[model samples]
Target: MTEPKIAIALYSYEPQEEGELLLLEGDILTVLEEDASGWWSGESNGKTGLFPGSYVEYVDEQLIESLGLEQFEEISEESNNTTEQDLTQQQGGEFSGQNINDENYVSDEENEKDNTSQNQNQQEIIQTQNFTRNIGGTTMIHDGFIWEEKEPVFKVTIGKTVKRKKLRGMKKYTAYLIHSGNFCVTRRYKHFLWLRQRLVERYENVPVPPMPEKQFQGRFGEDFISRRREGLNRFLNRICEHPILRSSQIFHHFLEADEYQDWKMGKRAAEKQNKKEVPFFKSITCAQEVTKDCDDEITEFKKNITSLDKCLKNVENVATDLYLSNYQDLSASYLKFSKAFLKLGSEAKGIVGKNLDIEGKELKERGKEQRKIFIDPLKDYNRLIQVFIETIKVRDQANFQYVSTHAKYTKQNMGELSGQNRDKLLLKQDKSDRMTNITLAEIELFHYNRLRDSKEILTNHLKTQIEYYRKSSERWKKVKEEVEKIPVIHGSKKLEGMEDLSEPELFDEKIETDTEENQTSNQIDKEIEKNDEDNEEEDDEDTDDEDTDEDDDDDQTEETEEIEKEKDENEKNEKEKDEKENNDDFEKI
Candidate 1:
């Protein structure tokens, strides 16, 4: 048999003339023919040219297939199994590592046991033993992303369990009520963790929403439980929203299974069937509207996801900071403010102190509004973004397989055109095409859903912000008005000159300088406006007599003695004394 002409370049070569092939080290070539001269004519990188015979080393074409297949097989094997903890893929929150797919697999001893009566299943399995039959392939995709729903949404009516009774009255564990749509089942955190694990393992083509990170120490706390419950709800919401996942047997089993034994059987069945490779994708095809070449679409989708994730992540971070700084401790901080004000108001013994109490209560209400209207949804949105990214990553895995198989077929196609090789090539081509189709479908579905979700989440987020700000502004405005109603002498205790604040200081040289200073909490006297006209009449007289130094000084001395006689009563009686003292004390507090 004539060996197939193949050579590996031993040295780099730059083409010096037209029709001469360029050669780099290790460059493979097809040895078309050789002339009697030292120069050898060959095809390299699609160019037919002659090169120095010494620059190339020939190898048997048959070895290439064997070697290439070994490397590709290793890649395929590695992809099937990965050791790194994919924190984002499985139980998103802190969860003990558990393999849902393997844990659910039927064991030898269990298989021998009668499963029919012991299933204790809440819902009946398909009589035909195929759940997909009812699920139908048509519903799994909308423009190619699986499970685009048009009929009715798969909803988790209650995601968070407000109460968890101890399992079997055992203090060691608590069973949370996990409800999906009409089904309600008691499940532990581990069960949810495993569900996510199985999903990540089984659907290399689907992104499993990550659970919230585990809360180790505070897991039992009400706040932690509430947050985790909400997070779990969001996770389930994503699962239900996914067209492919909505009818998942394993997920349904989790939601509807009654006894522990039945849950095990359902888990086993779900996993055993997981060995079947993307059975749901068998009926799916790339739609006509999608681009013919999936590589371009994938590239475009990837770029778009990168930009979108970056933008969303940044927004999520900003919201997180806002929540933490402003609303997380909002209740505690505001209540503390209320305490200080109430204490100061008691000391002031005037309307100013009463108004301070109102201000404090309004602060508390402002914090409450922010947390209710804006904080929760923003947090939910942040978690959703992470889930969306993990889902997008599923396509990367599928793309890898497609690229690997395509490479194998392309290399093998370059080999000897034997009957057996031709058949293998056809199979490889079909597989590559199938992967391409699925990837394209997912890209379309992902893009559409992302846009839809973003619009929905964004609209809700903005509306909440508007509501939160609106309530806060109106509350504070009310506070400002009440603050201004405080009597001048009783408004603030330590504002030395505020009590003497003239209603009309327009003719005074110091008027401009004192204007801003007089307009603070110290000026909360309701009587100021009523005195404006009365005081304005004295403005012209005061300005005209400014240069009568000796007479004005003698008159001031007589008035000072009278003021001194009343100083003791006025000193503690002025609201400025209490207001100033309150401001200083609150700052320290």
Candidate 2:
């Protein structure tokens, strides 16, 4: 075995058998078998690894001589046409294989002749392969490079043939292989070829749409290239350094030097920008203006919300206070009513007992006149009952008025607040809905109960007062009956008393007279009839006059009140209208 030559093939040298003869072909070298029938090994500096003689051929001097005369003759012609200065310039580097085929056994004369003929033959071959034409034709290219037409297209063929005998016994072999499929070399090669084909198709012979006159008008039609040239350079230099184009080393080098830094700086700046918090995007055209308007509206809405909060608080306070006041008044009236009822019960009991006693009382007729002594204060009892009923009516009316007025104002305020606060709740629909949930009826109920409670308290009170009046009348009647039971003498002249009265009888007579002096007493027989007729006439006349005046006055007062209310409302509306007109004019400006 021979060691591969280190000279010339240093880029592809490899060890071989120590005794093998390594032959040379220019900078290429090969190891030969002992018989020298063919080369066993060879190397080239520009290629990977060593090559076997089966795949490589040597260009020795003998082989060069055998190349024939034409190719050499063509080279000689081209070389001769050039000046000596040009030859010197072209031949500045070493040409190492000038004597490669100079055989040691051949005569110098024959060698010279052989060299000359060989050179001529070489020239013809060179010339034959080097013809140039002035022909013009377009050659559509693939990937804009690589003249693929001259090379045989790579292909592999498959025929419908199989190792039937071997596969026959392995029934599931195909299925097994399919199930175990992976990205082995075969699959990878197929995928790589598919991707390559796609890439090639993408870059090949693309068409451009024709530009319309409208699109290419003015400077664009003729000077498009000139005008765009600077932009094109800037794009190539500045923008090409972006990651989309920078992946390829070949492309990366195409960018101008300064543009590389500019692109990097731009990316850094973009990243810095991206790091900042971004606002949510909306589709509004005047987004900034809309946002400002929204902010202003929001500020105003917040102020309104504050005002509403205050109003709600006030409502709560007022409602609570009104309820409490109504409750307190009702409670106070209830206490008063209770006391009056108790007193009335006592009086009624006393009156009933006294009436029974008075019905059993004795009356005496003396002298020529019928003088009656009676018991019971019936007139006082009737008057007290009347007073109690009148007081009750006054109390009930006052309570009803207070409750009605309160309910009216609360309901009106709720309506006005809902209307006036509409602007504040424009964006807050849920809040508005909640506000609408408040009811006029609920406030009405509260006021209604206040009146009911007050009425109940007063009714109870009136009942008690009536009872007390009855009781008082009963007690007075009892006292009157006891007084009338005492014996009395009407004669003042000692008459038929039978002798001079004793000291005791005398004192008794004095007491009887004094008691009679204190009473309007038994003389009411005449006075009662006369007074009854006169009182009846006066009462009828007074009642008729009162009824007529009350009806007339009530109608007149209602008409006056209605007229005044209308006037007030009209004035308020006019003032509001003026304010609104002024606001509208200011807004126009």
Candidate 3:
């Protein structure tokens, strides 16, 4: 098992493991004691306990050497001031020890033999006290300065006092220089571990040494140290240049708006926990996630809706009228339209997935492309129709001008003819008197000829104009018909009725009545003809009876008596027949 790199402060320290716990931001602590398990020895309050080795990272040997040298220098500086009483006090009680506070520390008269030395030492102590009490209007301390708010950090055993610079801007400024104010300066600390992690992230395939002690010596040298310092400086620069910090604190509200909003939202959510419905725009991106404008999502949804509408309209336009009338394959078409709508809606939803309000190139390009493909066509079609209508109007105006000019010219030239011709022209011009005059026919003849020629020219021009107008009108009519049939995407009727008429059965009653009347009239005419034929048949039968009566009398016997009576009747019938025949012959002749 790897040894712990730093010492950990426990209630007790014992010998169970070999590891070190970090202290003072960059201090490496060695395990004084260890056992078979993964526990390391650490000391606190004169008691030792087995601490876990895994809790510590081993420091490099070179760092330990440098620290020892620094320790030596500090030991020399305090050699004169070191007291057995001070040591005793540190070992006793709760051991509130780090740098000795004046409240708990003093010197014996024997130890203060040099009065000048004593004065210099007292002055130095006073100066150190003042510096530690306040640094740039903020409480700061040197090494081992323990405070209730701050953790105990081991001070440098020996170092020159750093000059206090203004640091500009604010009277009270706390520089975030040290990683942890209370921790020891050690090679194998969490801060160093973070630095190592950053290095690994930046440079792939970085060779890490198995033994942190050896590895630290090899890698974290002057160059790495320089890079780390540079990185730290850059981080500080970013904080200094931060908009909130650079500008007036009046803008602090805006900087804290997000946090304030989140807190407010959280309170609202807690208050209304029982209410299931969330208000629109209430649900927001969490603080950890980036937020974006809601308008983008709305626009994207609109585009998708438009696209689906277009697909539906195109399907309608392309579909055959006969097929639409009978509605064949309607199920498939409906499914297709539904699928398209759903897919487009899904795409629109995803367009702002996660960070819906964030701006990016992909979103911009998507919006642009959607407008071009879906919006431009309808606009172009509308513009073309408008232009077509205007063109037709212009053509009509031109035709009107040509007709008016021709009429005016025809009227004006007829007035230039000679007197007799002029008189004749005047007669012809008058609709009421054109045929009345044949006087001075020669002048009239010339004028009439000219008028005829002019009339022919005018007629031809009018005919051509009329034909052109008809063609243009027909063209426009067809176009308008097509456009009307084309489905209007939004707010248009879903199911269109037949173009022929809304109700085809409206004329059914009239048609039925007409059919019935025609049938009745034909039947009556046939009946009348049949009646005439029946009358003629009756007349023929009477004539035949009369002829038979003359031949049957004597041949009848008793039956002949009956026949003879019949023959008497027949004789009368035959006389009537002969009279009728004579009348028919006369009529024929």
Per-residue lDDT for 1-589 in model 3, tens only? 4453333221111232334322111122456656555555754224444455433334334533654645422332343223222332322112223222233235556644644464454334323322211011121211221111232222211111122226483332112233222322222223333333432232112111111112344243443333334333333232223211112111122123234465355434433321222111111111111112222332343354446456645643543232222232232232223222222222222222112212222222333333333333333333323332333333234334433443454467643333223222222222111111111111222234335534754565466546645764665565566546644467755443212223453222122234433343233334334433433433557667886886575456568578779999999999999999999999999
* Model 1 CA deviation exceeding 4 Å by range: 1-151, 159-171, 259-261, 276-278, 289-292, 326-418, 463-589
lDDT of 2 by residue, 390-486 (tens): 3333323433443344345446654322221221221122111111111111122223433553475456546654665576577667668765664
The better candidate by TM-score, 1 or 2, is 1
1 or 2, greater by lDDT: 1
User: In model 3, how large is the Cα lDDT of residue 585?
Assistant: 100
Local accuracy by lDDT, each model? 0.53, 0.31, 0.32
Ordered list by lDDT, greatest first:
1, 3, 2
Reference-based lDDT, residue 240, model 1: 83
Off by over 4 Å in 3: 1-39, 52-365, 368-589
Candidate 1 positional error at 357, Å: 6.0
* lDDT-best of 2 and 3: 3
Q: Candidate 2 — what's its lDDT?
A: 0.31
1-589 per-residue lDDT for model 1 (tens digits) = 2334766654445555777776643456777766544467888656788776656656544554655634423332232222111211222111123222232234466652543232322112112122233224333334443445534557774444544446675655545777665678888778889898777665555566667677668667766676666667777877887766666667777789978899988887666556532333434443322223445666676677667667766765676556544443443333333323322332332334444434444544554444433455455555655665565555555445534543565476653333333333323333334445556655666667667866876676688667766876776676677667766675554743333323443222132234333333223332223233323443556555774776889999999999997996797678778999999999999
Q: What is the clash count of model 2? A: 41
